[model samples]
Each structure stands twice: as C-alpha cells, then as structure tokens.
Target: MERESDVDALIAEGAAAPVDGWAFDWLAGRAAEERPPWGYARRVATRMAAARAALDVDTGGGEVLAELPQSPPLLVATEGWPPNVTVAARTLRPVGGRVVAVTPGAPLPFRDAAFDLVVSRHPVRTDWAETARVLRPGGTFLSQQIGPGTVRELSEAILGPLPPPADRHPERAVADAEAAGLRVVDLREATLRTVFHDVAAVVWFLRKVVWTVPGFTVERHRPALVRLHDRIRAEGPFVAHARRFLVEAIRPAD
Candidate 1:
C-alpha cells in the first residue's frame, strides 16, 4: 500500500504534461457548444451587462468571452498558461477582448479594485483572494469550477482508496469568498453524466480531459486500465461523470 503523502507527490508532478489529444479536442468542442444563447451563456451575458469594466480569469480558448457582446471597451482576459493565453487572444480578438498570460496564485497585474466584474471558469482556488482584491465595491465575481468528486470513480480505481477531501469543496469555496470580503449570493453544483465508447476511451479522457494527479505513474495505472477495460467490456458503454459549480458573489459595497 502506498502512503497518502507519496501518492499526492506523484499526482502533483504529473499534472503538467500535455493532456490527451482526444480529450483536449472534446473539451474545446464543448466550450464552443456551451456558449451564448445556450445554457450558461445567457447567465454570463447577464453578468457582463452589469459591469462597466470586466476581467475574465483563465479564459481558456476564450470561448466564454467570445460569446459576450462586443461592447465593453475595457474587457481584458488573463490566462495562466502561455499557450492558452495565446489561443485566447486569437479566439477573443473578434470581441475586442485583450488576453495576457499571468502566473496563477500570485498578485494580479491590475490595480486594486480595478474591475467592475470578474469572471473565471475552473480557476485555481489559490487565486480567489486575488480575484476579490481586484474587484471594486459592489462588483460581481462569477466563477464556474470543478467541484469535489470530479472523476471520483477514475481517481479511486487508479489510486486505491480515496484521499481526504481537499479545498475543492463547493462549500469551502463559498466560505473562501465570504472570507475574502465577498458576499456569496449563488453557489450551485451541476453534475453532468457523459458516455464513452469504452474503458480505453475513458482512460484516455482522464489522461487528457481530467489531468490526473502528479504522482500517477503511467506504469502504475496499467493494471487499473486493464481492469477498467474488462469492466467496460462486460458492462457495455461506460458512464463518466463531471461536476461544475456556478458561484455568483458580490464584493462588499463598503
């Protein structure tokens, strides 16, 4: 049995590798589909309308920003990954949104209270405080992110017993928002169940889409892969799960 600490170290290390091609393309397509006039696009638009100036954090592929109206002159986007920032700039150019790459979990480049609205999708929790710091009084902070139990089954199968829940909890995020002097008005979790052709597809998706923890050795996961394949072959089309939390909060008027 591997010690919990050992497992964590491995996952942290492996998370930086490029995600699988199939999974990356699938996510890119999903981002395009989930844009405006459809589902969350309406909500995002509504939020953007309320702000004089807007800042989008981690604007991956700029799909969310692209859906909004091209009216906000001060629209700016930041992505932590260089490649993602480059892609976002191209994707958001038509909407006149400027994209810049910045390090996650650090002070934002903008001045304090500089933005009227701050939006993020799947941003690192470490940046929550900085997000609040950058928003003006009464500014809205809207974020959508993966919650705990995201890919729980795959994680458990590959890593043995599940680890203790970390800060990814939606409740904890609400608390973090409140602690950062932001009022949490809406915090909701949406679970989406997706189907894949086979266990191999599922494994590839996890490698690319989910980005398993750093410590996960491809070699160590081979047995788990075999087991998953066997199970899927016996069970038919496999069910994969994903969860996203939609949170809308306001920086205190004071």
Candidate 2:
C-alpha cells in the first residue's frame, strides 16, 4: 500500500516531466495499452523499403519513423508542435530524414506529386486533399489514426459527461479519401484495453494528450484527479478502452 505522500510525489513528478515530443518513456510500466493487431510499425517498415520517396505527416518526435528498419532514399517528415520538431530533427538525423515545422490545418510544405509513399501515426488532422496532391501516380497513403472518442473513460474521469463525437469514423474517412480521388484499399478499427496502474499515470497521460480534457492541468483538475486517486487506492487500477483505426489508400495508377 502506498502512503499519501508517496502518491503525491509521483503525481508531482509526472506533472513536472516534459510532455514535449510523442515519447512516453515516462509512462513505462506505469500504464499499459493493448496494441492494435495490425502491427502498424512493421507494416510501415515494409512499405518504406519499397518506396523511392516518402513523407511522414505529423511525425511527433519522429519516434515511430526513426524505428523503421529501412527508409526510402528521400525521407521527409513534418511536425506541427515546435518542441517536437526539435526532438524529431534529432531523432531522425541518423535515418537521413528531414523534419519540417508545419502549421496545423495549413498546407503541407511539399510539392505536388513529391512522394511515392506517405505515412502518419495518430495525426492531429488528415488533410486528404493535400495527401492526394502530394502522392505520385500509384503512390500509397497509410495511417493509424485515433478513432472517435478515444480514451473517453479517462477523459470523462476528469471532465463530466461529454457530447459524442460527430465525425472521425472510418466510413467518413473512406468517403473523404474517395472524394479526394484516392481509393481506400483497406480500413480497420479496434478498441483496445488500457489500464492506468496509478493516478500518476492518468495525470501524465492527460497532460501529454491535451485533447483528452482540452485544458487539463494538475491544479484545475486536482479535485477530479484526487477523486480518481482515491478510487484507484480502493479499486486497484483504473480501466479504459482506447479506440484506434487504420486506413490505407492509393492513388490510381492512371
């Protein structure tokens, strides 16, 4: 059994840790999440091996991209968050990839038909038209996206009952892909089990994933966090389900 002081220390440690870059090393073993069965990283490595030029959108810290066993000759990545851009540049340097600081919802800084393959993992937003424009004939776009209402169990723990998501369904994504003149070759969705072993884990996650509560701060949500902490102390770990989806599209060979 953890003492109250110990728990408070953990929470403070989590709150002070840098949330920049997508790396979650801080949460190692503190929380666990089931991975989607599709093995997105291995799939990306396979595709990268066959491409001549590739771009990665919203490449947070280049953590996933840097792990690729192989990379295309011309590798480029974009990051919207400034802190992550620096981290990504450093992480991707050894892999010979360039990182661009991009503005959210703004145009991608690349030429039309510039890449043969484009990939992103959990992009903040998918610019379907820009994705189509950047791909050469017969190029492919592969992404693992956070589906609607991901981690609602955690979000609602902090904020009270919320409205249901109106969009981000795979069907909507397919329609948008088709509308952008890309063919949706494959798409899949999954709900994975997630467990926060401690309140500190929950606090760290909410801070890193800002969308969870929009404006989650230790001070603002301390009351809710305390409530959750008490619940954990009594009920073991807090359980939640994380939603994710995989979408693959290809530009027509014509």
Candidate 3:
C-alpha cells in the first residue's frame, strides 16, 4: 500500500497545477480517455479549407484551430475566458486567425452573415440563434458537444450518487438548430472509456473541468479524496465513461 504521505503529496501537486487553456497535456501518463470515431478536428480542417470566412466559437486557446492546414481569408475566433484570449491569439498567429473576447452568454459581437462557416468544440452552451444569424446563406455550423451525463462515473466517485443528466441530448440539439432556422444535416454520439491511473489525475481533471464536481475543493472534499485514493490503491485504476456528440447544421439559402 502506498503511504498516506505519498497520497497527500500527489493531491497537492494536482491542486497546484495551473488550469489555463483547454489542452490536457498535464494528464499525459496519469490518465487516458478514448476518442470518438468521428474525427472532429479533421472534419473542421476540411470544411475550413473550403470556407471564404470562418468563425470558431468558444475557441479555447485556439489549440485545435491552430492545427488547420488551411485557413480561410477571414478567420476569426471567439473566447469568453479572458486568459485564453491571449493564449489563443498567440497560438493562432501563424494561421492568421484573430481572437475576440466576449461575455459568456451574450450575443456574438459580429455582423450578420459575416461568416461562411462556424465551428465549436465542446462549447459551454450553444447559441443557435446567434450562430445562425452570423452565418452567410447556405453556411454550415459544425460542433463536437459534450453529451448528457458525460464523465458521470468520475463525478459520482467524487460527489456520490447524483440526479440523471437532463440536457445536451442529440435530439434536443437538432430541434434547437431547426428552431433557429438551420437544417440539421448530421448527428452522431459516442461513449468513450476513460481511465484515471491515480488520484492526482482525478483532482487535476476536476479542477480543470469544473462541471465535473460543481464546486470541488481539496479542503472541502478531503475525506472523499482520501477514500478515492484508498480505493485506487486497493483496486485497479478508476474507470469512467465520457459521452460526446457531433452535430452539423446548415443555414438555408436566401
């Protein structure tokens, strides 16, 4: 059995790590999560190649957008998190992409029909109406979204049993897109296996992905963390499932 001191040290390390940007490089060897079958990044790259103007909503750190081989003439990205704006701007500099900071829930600050393509990856919330309003006629909107009950097992491990997930249903997204005057073209869902090799990984993940445990704190949840650490030492690595969905919609021609 690992010493209690070792566990405490691991927890402290995780708690001290910075949670800036959307990248998960910190969890490299300690955790693993399976990716969806559909390659969301590759899909975005393909679409972006054909777009005259493209907008990336909630483009955290512009990590994914920076990887696109080709950038549209007018490439723009929006981020609600202030710290990520500068990070995104620097990352996307080589691609000639601009990052704009905006309020989380406010309407997008852009002219109507300004973009021929819009994309988002794991947005906190989808503003379907605002997305449609900013797209040019016959433009496409593509997104990889977090599905309902995503990473619930990890959450339950930390916070105990919880209520059923009530939102982020694929059907609901289709309906919302249609209501916003966009035609849904495709939808897909995936449940991925996620494994955490150590308690530190769990703590870091919860800190970075705040939605996992609402208001998780090492001090407040020390007992639970201890229990989980013990469980990991006794049993094998803790296992969880992450759910994701991809949706595509297109604004009709004027």
Q: Which candidate is the best by lDDT?
A: 3
The number of clashing residue pairs in each candidate reads 8, 0, 0
lDDT for 193 in candidate 3 is: 98
Query: After superposition on all CA atoms, how large is the RMSD of candidate 3?
Result: 1.1
1 versus 3: better TM-score goes to = 3
Predicted candidate 2 versus true structure: per-residue lDDT over 1-254, tens digit per residue: 46668668878977887888898888888899999999999999999999999999999999988998888999999999999999999999999999999899999888899999999999988999999999999999999999999989888889988899876788999999999999999999999999998888888899889888897889999889888888898999999999999999999989
Model 3 has how many clashing residue pairs? Answer: 0
Candidate 1 lDDT tens digits, 88-124: 8888889888987888776889999999888887776
Local error of candidate 3 at residue 244 (angstroms): 0.3
Query: Which ten residues in a row are the worst by lDDT in model 3?
Result: 1-10
Q: How close is candidate 3 to the true structure, as a TM-score?
A: 0.98
For model 2, name the residue pairs that clash. none
lDDT measured at residue 52 in model 2 versus the true structure, 0 to 100: 98
Question: Which residues of candidate 2, in runs, are more than 4 Å off?
Answer: 1-7
Q: Which runs of model 3 end up more than 4 angstroms from their true locations?
A: none
Superior candidate under TM-score, 2 versus 3: 3
lDDT of 3 at 200: 93
